[model samples]
Target: MKPSILTISACGIFTTGIAFAGEQHLTCPARLEPDAIQPNHLPAGWELHMLRPVYLTEGGMLHGPPEESAFLVPDNSTSRKAGKQTREMQHWSFDVPHGYTMWVYCGYGGGGATLKLFQQVTESATECTLSSQSTNGRTKEVLEFSCK
Candidate 1:
């Protein structure tokens, strides 16, 4: 038997149950627009790619204890050319609930030394703050953002 679909509203739809002739409706939460949820204090020159939510498992192995939550914002900025190769620097913003420390890594393309950048934690109730640092001729770098 073919099931009949009924329009409930913009949020969901109703349909006849497959097992029986009973009416069933599926409801979903309203979706929020990107601008409506994005932070107002994003850096001046950086562009927001997307918002990422992170969940850590118990007993953090690589770094810290598990059961930690953090939000990551991956962004793309202007390209910088070092020597003959033009490379894109990696930019990341991290938001953690509690006070925590993180590290950023930068490396050159051709067997060059790697540079480590650190983040300065700024305490705020609504948002996290990330410190801006120059690549200093490095081709790519990872920036750590700590939010308290």
Candidate 2:
């Protein structure tokens, strides 16, 4: 079943942070539009090929990465007080294309996500032959899950 989160109207990776202690926030995917993006906003690390759209994992709205970010630092002071920004994101955004959306997330550090979504390769009318795929795992499973 799709998440009730589908009711949302915008999508993006938004976060809040702390300076030196453990933290938490009320987080959810927001809904948005394609034109909300600027031409230069979709950088390589954020997109597949230049024209490919990245889909958000919730209602699957395509959105850019957060404009602002949050980080953690040592509560006890030192020059370490300035704190380093964390690029090791637990959450990320994928901008959509033509209003089509697909969203994904990993359980932790990308452990649960699979390969990129792709259309199957097909034979060329005048040239191609056959293609074969050999692998250890033949089937991958996606299931409905939630965390409290």
Candidate 3:
């Protein structure tokens, strides 16, 4: 029957598995300056070393053909001191063709620098929020932003 044939065809397609195109990764940093500090801004001392967007696939983030970018930040606030440093990790993510450039500084956090992690939104961005953690504690900053 046609129904039986259709079921067979569907099964065949599913067995083939999906083929993904490709992906990319880029690590960026954000070095904060005195003037850069504002309400809800990145913590003090932490610096961003990489900032980039990347195209992803089924298996995972690809590295070639239709690739993009990714970012990495340094842990400048490893100390438990208050004014010593900003103990935490900061991450930013979005889609909808977002774009941003940076300006690093010379100052470092109270302790030292560590690395942070983040996730991204695809296709479109709405009510985006970059998360941040301090002194290895719970998230402290929720940066509300809009993607262009």
Task: Determine the C-alpha RMSD for candidate 1 after optimal superposition of all C-alphas.
Answer: 19.8
Q: All candidates' lDDT scores?
A: 0.29, 0.23, 0.24
lDDT agreement of model 1 with the native: 0.29
At residue 3, give the lDDT of candidate 2. 29
Model 1, 43-140: lDDT tens digits are 88976643432211111001112223232344444556656544443344444446464322212223432211112222222332332233453322
Candidate 1 ranges with C-alpha deviation above 4 Å: 1-74, 77-89, 105-119, 123-148
Worst lDDT run of 10 residues, candidate 2, spans 119-128
My TM-score estimates for the predictions, one after another, are: 0.23, 0.18, 0.20
Tens-place lDDT per residue, model 3, 1-148, is 0100101121221111111232212122222223322233447987643333221100111111111333324322122336523333323342223353221111123222322212232233222222222333322222111222
What local lDDT does model 3 show for residue 62? 14
Candidate 1 vs candidate 3: the TM-score winner is 1
